[model samples]
Target: MTEGLSLWSLGLAVIVVGALWIYGVNRTMMTVPPEAQKLSPDSNRWSKELMRETYERVKKNPIDIKKHLPPKLDRRYIVVGGSGLVGGDIVAHLLARGQSPEGIRIVDFAPLRRPDILGVASNVDVIKTDITSPNSVKAAFSKPWPASVAGLPLTVYHTAAVIRPGERSLQTYDRVARVNVGGTANVLAGAKEAGADIFIATSSSSVAVKPMKFWKWPLPSLASNYVQVFNEDDFDQPLKAHDEFFGNYARAKAEAERLVCAANQEGFRTGVVRPGNGIFGDVENDVTFGPTLKAGDIVSWTPHVSQNWISSRNVSIAHLQFEAALNPSVRAVPPPCAGRPLLVTDPCPPITFRDFYSTVSTLSVTPVTETYPPPVLMLILAYAIEGWANLIINFPILTKLFGWKEPTGDLAMLQPAVFTVSAYTICDDSRARKSVEEGGIGYTGVTDTLTGFCEQMAVWNARVERGEAGPLKGKGAAAPVVA
Candidate 1:
């Protein structure tokens, strides 16, 4: 009886200590920095009137992505992942600059879904190719170009990638590696075999963002690594261990970037563009804005978080600029932009999560609601979810024994790694903005954050007005809580 009582006492003590530890960590991390607070949006910025006026302005003077496009090159182009966000924009920019539709091809796993891209889809070649399958990639590349642009040099833009920001388990690394790492190698080989002269792959700025350490016991302070300034400095160092990256997605991207850079040669030039976190601008299914607009109501824990965002249009511009810099016809000698990664972001200061919610809430004709739970509680729940997920993933037999199923959608994304990536992140794109002659890509962003968000919201609002907007469907209906 005494031993039973002692065991119960021990269990209760353990629970109490765990609870206290979580509370302490939460208290420490909840203290917002004065500098970050200054970046938060003013309450007035959320006013409906201001947002309506901004929407009006955006509709009146829509961002002219064409004005920022590079001069149309006399070359045939192949954009891998061209049906998606950045790749789709690259195709649009190419067509906008008068590149013949017959001169361009889109090789992607997904079909052409974007309405804007669909309008011109008939004119361009759209091939459904799975990058993970070497044979599929080879066949896609081997497909003949039309006779009109057959003689032109080939420039390939590889923008396809599988994104899972919340997953950090090594056991699940293969899920992302197949596409991000192995698939990149497949595409690289295919591009070379196709006699491509210029190759550029889309990478992520999160490669430089380290994981946050939130369990500092003795020190009553926030995680020292919570605030990050991302640039290309990490590229100069050796790749970090998988554990060092924010999640599997970032680690895979880093490896892919390395392969692309290493493949740079005298005849074939290669480069990478790492777009900042929160890639948006596609009204249908972009990671940032589209999901929120679709959901209409959001539950968030990142009101205090601040990070950089990049529009698809700006990311596309950077790719074309990189291509121009690497083009042998444009440069007399080997350019500095070759075999390097350039960071790109919207031309605006990093804004708090509140700013994003405010913009959507105010601009949308459909009533949008946002609920913020205590961040500490969310963090605790995230750890629990991750632990449960890891158990299910590491031991598949549990499914047979207990009928356990893997988490999906938003629940699957509630892992601890989400907090790390969602932390305050600032991206510096000075190198990319430098002139090509000065050893940079000469990238100039087309729209600022507010204008870009306003433009997208304007489109969605117009859709709602036209009675075309409908409830979001499919597994992608819920937006991941991570930025």
Candidate 2:
């Protein structure tokens, strides 16, 4: 009886000490705003590790044989948002599959916070340039790939955007749009100039038929998120900017989609990938979709329903699949991939908001406090805890030698690694063909394709938790948990 009691006490103590350790680190960690969070020192160091991991997964082309194209167009690949969550996974998959890193180019506005990009510095050519700028976009296209690639044998994988705050005003919208829509235009312009053969674009699944739930949320309290669509005539009402956050991102993306579909060239062809939400990994530590708050009902999602989720890694794989289709050298996947909209998501049926959250709940050792901690103090407290815990875990000798308290906190963010939802949207990927045939993008009937994403999200999340990502160096990771 005494031994059992002692064991229980030890467990409790370990848990308590763990909590204290994280609390100390988090408290001191400096925080950057959502819009401007850059890579920290520790995170940067870790990013190098991620760079290595990413190169391992992404170096190989998923398509072993080019479907029909010649050898010159087969090897070179470029992903614009390679540092972002979804883009990051695509890079990882490529490296893991054994694509030559020297042949890959990773271009993003901001660097990644994970270690994948950091480790592959030697293998990859990381470029920081604004694709919206004609010169910049042209330069990227004109750049030479591997020695084997034709004089300008480059394949374009575009995912750059000037979204969010950048879309807040008409001026902002134009600026942002210039990057997405204008950038694509330039990519084509340069592709033509450089004799590049194929391009694959990351298009949003935000249908023009309906305003997204993100645009509808907090209608009465917060600024409206819905804005004017490119095809406003289709909507029941005239398109207007309803959301402050909606300023220009939607319009730009909408316009960009229009531009890509109209991409008819003599030598080159294009493919578009529309992935529904649930694409969470880590970059900004953001889960844009959640229960009832900001998710889509891919199928029969009523206002009573929650949002949909997708694993960014899976989305990355799907996008990579599209990339493989573009390679002109080896036989890839199904032919006729160019100029097609492939909807990539999950395979599970929908679930209620509550059930979704219950499945992804994590073990948080920190006591929930009602009082709000000041932002500055919060940073201090968070880092203090994180530092102490890392020290204890990485240096166990210190634990025994110094008699340190064992940390037991939300360090196990094992659960809810991806976005946790109480409810989600349902979708149908099978109908996407019809939408494409109709010169539009959507699933057949009313079945939203996002329904498939939920099931895959679990598997992708599991893989992410299996490793400790190091994207940005120098900085401690803010809890990936939703605030």
Candidate 3:
């Protein structure tokens, strides 16, 4: 009898332990951060006091108009984010168009890297600028223009922005707001002060997208319906301020767009372009540093999700063509590119991630299938990781010792929505093309763009194999080699 009792007791203990473990796992999966509560202004992660102080600084130092009257119009370009990928390409395009190096000025918070890729344009003036600070922006614009292009109206391309996943957290949201929102105000004010009549700014399609509302498993299929294809008309449908993940970034961008549009009257003619997923060839980062899978590299395939993508080169071209359409003659009164933001994207069918990946695949004798974690399981994992991050960041001692910061829950929800189950995600580039006879800067076919990207990757990979390119951090590390 005693032996029988011992066996029963052991069984009971095992059952209890298993139940406890399951309970803990379930709780973690359901956990949501305390900060992401409502989709309202009260849900803004930033401290109110910090926002007020930053706004006051922007207002105190208004743009000086005396120095910037009668805008010059002879291709005297002032690129705000000139060191970045798209911005760098714009500079390259300018050089290709035979614009003198002295005629171009690049203003960025950080110095440009890989000047060799830019043909080592010795005459291009590089200004170190902090867009968030009104004084810094003023100082950047105050620099005298080259005498040769001094009389021509300058076209300001303000593309500098703070875009990162960590921006969703309370610790970093204020910095995003100050720079993206208030910084844009300063740019508009500075442009007006500098007599910059033509302005082009870069915006993202995220401004019009809403977070996915996932369906339950078994009955509804656990996927969202392809009910809507986002267009320029949907600009009003923005992510709420209290959205769990991308809300802050979306809200801040919306504000910046508003600022740019509001400044499009009389002396200032401003236009904004909203791009879809932008991917392209990176010579500086992809070649000189590390190389990922290149053309002719054997790569496996998977049934990947589909989304719209645009080439970086096309984005650069569209900027110039839009400017040309707005003001045909150098001194003619240009029309305002306001009322609506143009949606610029490649004229290609929605391509699956696998289709994109296959561009670099080698000619293999046999095909291979790539496998990925189940979406449901991955979602659960995201919740658990986020919960763990919240615990670490909330505890003062733990944070101090481990240097723990709140991780933006981007991977948990936003990424899954984008990669696994996105709705009709194509942007219509027709209106922008019709507005200008250039037709969206004569977009390159999707296949050609993919081929071009793969070719560049191949070149870089060959260099790495030959030891011409030194050791890279990893397959594709995120190092700011360009900007």
Candidate 4:
């Protein structure tokens, strides 16, 4: 009787645990928004008829550069969000092109926070401005340029944006819209008021991508599972299609880009540059592949999904080229890229996620290739980890106890989806390359870029050791690492 009672107790405990697990996964862990379910690759919503009509109507006619001369370079530059990775790189490139540091002004909310990753001299004005407030933007722009160049034409690069504000809710969505959409409008207003001649808004390739639930679809071997490479002419997906189609970040960027292009006029030429899966250069002590390289740590992520990555350095160069072509300098030539958003990517074909991770390992002296979990299992864990991370980030004591270091306290990012979601989207930058007057973006060499990126990581790791960067609180925290 005692033996029987013990057996019954064990069975009951097992049943209770199984029931709780199912409930947790279904009710608490799943984070996929309901808007995601409305998407169907085969739906008439994505009709070919609509694509063909858009192709014919929205297609840009060939631009004749011979008829138009390049603009002059006698212009002052304003780099909004210049403290960021892309903006910092743009500042560096502008300096390398012989633009005086005094000629450029960087406006950012955290002007003094970011390190001089690109070695921008202190002479470049770092104005603290809240882009969300028009009054703030006006004040920043009101700061006069040097007396010698006071009357020069103004070229403004508005690259400031906000994303993943700790939680996925209506409030977070509103914040994103305020900064990305409303802030962009303010920048346009400020530029026009300031008599700016040229404006370029930084956008993302995600504007053209749709979120896909890959686990429910066909297996990895199916070609249909992979996203088709998007071209400039594929404007079928409207900006307001659905929030989950590309999430709030992409949606806001799409809206902002539309505004910039619409704001283009006879005197003020506005354009957008959409960079694909930008990674590999960041001055902020955020999570990246650098830590894994240092530890020779093997990680796990989704495999076989295709992704296209563009170097931040290359993106900076593209922005400068577009600005130069519009500045009317004797050295500048009329580039075919203007008045519309152009996709930027490496000339090479998209690579599988597994291959990308392996390439990083290969590039690093301490190699660390990633393993893969079955798709369904990986998705479940992704949902669970996101929930766990969100909970832990709130309680500092809990995080310290478990050994996790999130520099930014608000760590409720859709972290796991980087491997699963981003891997499936691809953007083609052929138009950007062909559109440039020089025939190419000049930074098409991926190998060289990767080598340079690895070197930068080495330097970054050294800084982390010296306590100059990374999360300040957590001394020895460990979290589940992913791509």
- Candidate 3 TM-score over all chains jointly: 0.71
Model 3 spans with C-alpha error above 4 angstroms: 1-73, 166-172, 215-222, 225-228, 236-246, 283-303, 328-336, 363-371, 392-397, 401-424, 437-448, 465-468, 473-483
Q: Cα lDDT for residue 344, model 1?
A: 93
Answer with 1 or 3, whichever has the higher lDDT: 1
Q: What is the TM-score of each candidate against the true structure?
A: 0.93, 0.53, 0.71, 0.70
**lDDT per residue (tens digit) for residues 1-483 in model 2:** 999999999999989876555443333222221211121112222133343343333333222222312122235667777777666766666666666787678877676655544564456777776776778866765676667544445666777665432113353345566677888787667656766566777765443323222212213122112121122222223333434122355556656655664673535667676665344544234343222111211111121233334556546555655545455554333245456555555444333333333222311111111122332343334346546645666688986897886434233211110111111223335533333224333322212222222322333333336643223121122233222
lDDT string for model 1 (121-192, tens) is: 668888999999999999999998889999999999999999987899899998999999999999999999
Give the range where candidate 2 is weakest over 10 consecutive residues by summed lDDT: 413-422
lDDT of 4 by residue, 45-83 (tens): 213343334333322432222222223266788999988
lDDT of each: 0.86, 0.46, 0.57, 0.61
Clashes (candidate 1) = 0
**Alpha-carbon RMSD to native, per candidate:** 2.9, 17.7, 13.8, 11.5
lDDT of 3 by residue, 1-483 (tens): 999999999999989976555444333323222221221122322243433343344345432322312223366888898887677767766766667788888989877764334565556788999998899999988788778888887788888887643234564466678888899899888888888877888887666665554443323323333223455665545434545334456667777877787677766777777776544546454221122332222121112334566666667766776676556464255543443477776655454444444433331112222334344454455456556655765676877887766544334333332422233344556666563433333332233333344444455545656665444442233221110
Best by TM-score: 1
In model 1, which regions exceed 4 Å deviation? 1-20, 35-50, 472-483
